[model samples]
Target: MKLSLNSFVVVALFAQFASARDTQIPLEWDKKVTWTEKYGPQSDQPFSGLLSFSHLPYTRCLENEATKFDIAVLGMPFDTGVSYRPGARFGPFAIRSGSRRQRATNGYTMSWGNSPFNQGVKILDCGDVPISPFDNALAVDQIEVAYSTLLDRPSAEGMGERDITRLISKDGIEHPRIVTLGGDHTIVWPILRSLHKVYGPISVIHFDAHLDTWEPKTRYPGQTTDQSRVTHGTFFYLAKEEGLISNQSIHAGIRCKLEGLADIENDESVGFQLVTADDIDDLGIPEIVRRIRQRVGDTPVYLSLDIDVIDPGLAPATGTPEPGGWTTRELKRILRGLVGLNFVGADIVEVAPAYDSADITGIAAADFVHDFLSLFLAEKPPSVGPPAYREEL
Candidate 1:
C-alpha cells in the first residue's frame, strides 16, 4: 500500500471523554421548550418523556412511518451475531436515552450553522425490528425484509432523489432515507443485500477498528453451515460473495490486529481501501475526507460505523474493544466533510451501552446520529463539490 499505516491502528481515539453536563432536566427548559400557560404546553418537548430519539416520536405501522417522513431512524435489536460482548441489542434504546437532552428549540449546531430538527425534513424514530433471539437465520431475514419494506416507501417530499444510477421507485418519486440504529455489525450484510435490490451495488464508508472482511472458511473452519459462516467478523465476506459491494468501499480508523499481512490483501480483495486510525494523525481530517470523497465518486453510499472505531478507552461498549481509535469529535468532523455524498442509507452499530461509563459511548453514538440528520437535511456546501446531492425521497 502507498500509505504506510503505523502498526495499522484502527484507533480513531475515543478514549475517556468529558462527562456530560448535569443530566437532570433543566427547569429553564420548560420556558424555552414548553408553551406558556395561556396556550397549551408544547407537546413536542423531548426531555421529559419515553417518546423517541430527540423527542421526535412518530410511531406507526412501517407503512405509515415511511410515507410521510423524508428520513426515519429504525433500530435492529439483534446481537446474536456478535463474536464477543452481546449487549448491543440495547444500543438503540441507549442512543435514544442519550439524546433526551436534544430538543428542536436547541438543536442548532455550530458546525453546520443550522438546526437539523424542524428543517422541513420529516424525521421519525421508527422503533426496533422485533428480531428473534433464538433463530439467527430468521432474524437475518427479518432485518432484510424490514429494511426493504421501508426503502420501498415514498415520502411526502423528496430531498435528493436520483434515478441516474437506480430508480427510487415507480413514477420515480423519492424514497425515504433511513438512518438505522444497529444490533451489531453483521446486520450490515442483509442491509447491503436489501439495498442492492434498489440501488444496485453500493459503496460503503466503514468506520471500524477492525477489518471485518475475514473469510469465514478460514476463520471458522469447523463451521460449514450457511448461517454459521456469517458472524460479525465475516458478514462483509458474505456481502462480497453476494455481489453486493462496489469497489469504492473504504474503511477508516482500521487498527485491529490480524494474523498476518495476507488479511490486508484479503480486505482489498473484498473491495475496500484502508485509512488506518493513525492516518488521521498523519493526514488530518481534510485529506481523509478528500480521499473518501474521491474514492466513492458518484456512487450511492451506505455508511456503517462500528462504535469500536473510536478508541475503546473512550467508547468501550462495543463487542470488540480495540485500544486505539478515532476520537468522537474527529470522527464527527470527518463525517461532516461528507456533506454532499449520495448517501442512501446509514447505521451506527455495536454500541453496547450496558458497559459504558457515564453513558459517554451512547452519547457519542447519539451525537453521530444528530450529525446524520443535519447531513440529510442540509445541502452540500458550495466549496465541496460539482457532483451534488440527489433528493430521492
Candidate 2:
C-alpha cells in the first residue's frame, strides 16, 4: 500500500495511542488510595469556628480567660444612630460573610512580605455586642461596656495596674487590640470612649463622605432633646467633647453637602483637618499619604472608615451615597501607604447590606478590615516628634 505522508502520520499516532493505553497504572494502586483520609471531608463544606475577619478561632469576651489573644474581632450591631437609613445594623454580619472569600489565600501581603496571621499575634472573633434595638442610648452604653470589658483586665489580687498603651501578657494571658465591625458611624463614639480609657486621646484617621462632627440634633422627626441625640452624623462631636481624640485627627473623602459655612466651622471646632475628595485630584495620593503621616505622627491612632467614602458607583450599599468619591483601588493604595502608623483600634462602618447588590460594598468593607489588620500587625516605624494638633481659626 503506497501511503502518503498524511496516512503514515495517522497510522503512527494510532499505534502510539494503543501502546500507551495498554500500559495504564494498575487498578490495585487506585484501590489502595485513601481518598477520604487524604482530603478529609468535602472541600465545599462551610467552615466551622469561622467568624468574620479571618477563619480565626471564635471566643466570647467572658470565656477567653484561658486563651489569650492579641487581636479581637467584635461586631457592634446597633444602628439607631443613622439619620438617612436603618439597615446598618446588619453591617457586621454581611462583612463577616464576605470575609469568607479571603480564607483560601495564605494571609500574605506582598507589600509587607509576611503573612499577618503568621505574626506572633493571635486573633479571635469575640462575637457581636448585644445591643438594644429600641433604646439607642442603652445600646451605646452596652457597646461601651462591652468594649471596655474586652480591653480591660478585671481587678484581682497581685494583678498590677493595667497598661492601656501596650498589650500586656501576664500569668500566661495577653491583652487584646480590638477591630470592630461597626453598626454605623455612631458606634465609633463608644469605641473611642473604650480606647480613650486605655490609650488616652488618640488621633483618628476618618474616611467618610460627611465630617461626622456635626452638633447633636433630635433623634427623630418629632423628638426634641432626646437622649439618643448623638447620632452617626454627630458622634465625632461627642468624641471630641469627651476628650477621646487628639487634635491631629484628619478626615478624608468628604463630599456630602454640608450645612453652609457653619458645618466646616463646626468640624474645625472639633479639631480635624479636611482632605476632601477633590483634594485627591489637586494633591496626588502620595501627597495625601504624606499629609496624613505628618498629621498623625507617633500618636496612638484609631481608624474609622465609613463605606460611603468610596464612590456610590463602587460602593452603593452604604447609607449615604455620594457621587464624587474614591475608587476602591485608590482607597486601598491610601490604606497601604498608612502602614507603620500607631494604629490601636479600627472600624469599617455604614455597610447596609440591604442597599447592596452582589455584596460589593460588604466585600470592600471586609477587605478594608483585612488591610487594617495587616498594617496593625506590621512593624512600627521609628517615632517622630509628638503629633501636632491643628486648631480651628
Candidate 3:
C-alpha cells in the first residue's frame, strides 16, 4: 500500500507519542500517605482548643471560671426567629471561616492605618451559644442570657483602661465590648435587652433595608401569634416596648417595602429616623455620618449591621435582600466615618450563607467585625487616612 505524506507524518507523530508515554512516571494506585503538615493547626487558626475563629476558644461564660478578656467575638448560631428563611443558624460558622486569615499580630491595613489585632487587647473568640433550634423562645432566651453574662464580665485587668469613650457601666466598672457574629437580625433584640442592664437605654445605629420597627400586630393585621410578634422584622418594636433601646437611635440604609406609609410613622414612634439607601446620593456619605454621630453623641450606642444592607448583587447571602442598596466600599467608608463613636457593642447579622456565592457576603461580614473592634478603640483616623497598600500581605 502506498502511503501519502500526511499518513507518514501521522505515523511518525504516533510513534513519538508512544515513546514519550513510555518515559512518563506511572500514576500512584496505593492509598498510603507520606505527606505531612509542617505546623500544627493552631499556627494558622485563630482559636485555641477547637475548630473555630483564630482566637482563644471560649464559651464558658456559664461556668464560674470562664477565661476573662477585654473584648470577645461571640457567635449566635440561632436563626429560628427569622420570618423569611432558615440556615442563618450556620452564619457563625461561615463568618468565622471568613475571618480565619485575620491575626492580631501585624494586623495593620493601610485603609484604616491600624489593625484590631495590634490594639493591645485580648479579644477572644467566645464560641457560639448552644441555641436550641427547636424552640425560638428558648433560643432567644439563650442568646440574651449568654450575651448578658459576657457583657457584664470585667474588662482585661490592665488593658483597654485607656479607652476614652466615656462609656460607663451601672457598676462603675469597665465592661468588655463584644463583636457578635449573628445568625439573624432577631438576635439584636436580645442583645439590646442584655446591654440595657449594663448601660441603661443605649442608642442604636441600625444599618438595614427594612424598618425593623414594624408593629407586628398592626402591620400583619392577622398573623397575631406570639411567635409572629417577635421576629426579625418586629424585634425593634419589642425592644422599644421593653425600653431596652433609647429613642436616640437612627436607621441608615432604609429602603425596604412596608405595609404602608404608616410604617414610617411607626418607626418614628419606635424612635428611629430614617436614612434611606438613596440618601447617600442626596445627603452624601459624610453628611450621613454626621447625622449618625450627632444623634448618638457619646451615648452608649449599639450598632446592628445587616448583611442585606449591601446590595444583593454585592452580598446576596442574606435572607431578606432588597435591591438598590449600598456597595461594600460605601458601607466600609461610612463605618470608618463612625470611628470615634462611643459604641459599646455591635453585631453583623442576617448572613445566610446558603444563598451566598463566591463567599462575598461572608468576607464582608468578617471585615465588618474587624472594623467593629477598631471602632471600640476610638483612635482618630489620620486626616488623609492610612497609606495605600501595594498588595495583600
Candidate structures ordered by lDDT, highest first: 1, 3, 2
Model 3 residue runs over 4 Å out of place are 1-42, 45-50, 54-61, 158-161, 164-167, 383-393
Candidate 2 residue pairs in clash (backbone atoms < 3 Å): none
Per-residue accuracy of model 3 over 1-393 as CA lDDT, tens digit each: 999999999999999987787578333345553334323243543443344555444455546445788788888987877778777888988888777666666567766777776667777787878888888888888989999888777676434545642246677777888888888888898899889888889899999998888888887779888876878889999999999888899999988887688888888999899899999999888788888888888788899999889999999998888999999889887887877667788999999999989888887888888878877774675344522211100
Model 3 lDDT, residue 344, Cα: 83
lDDT of each: 0.81, 0.77, 0.80
lDDT tens digits, residue span 110-192, model 2: 54455667665567777888899898888888998888887775322221222234442223333467889988888898888
Task: Give per-model CA RMSD.
Answer: 14.1, 7.0, 6.3
* Clash numbers, per candidate: 27, 0, 5
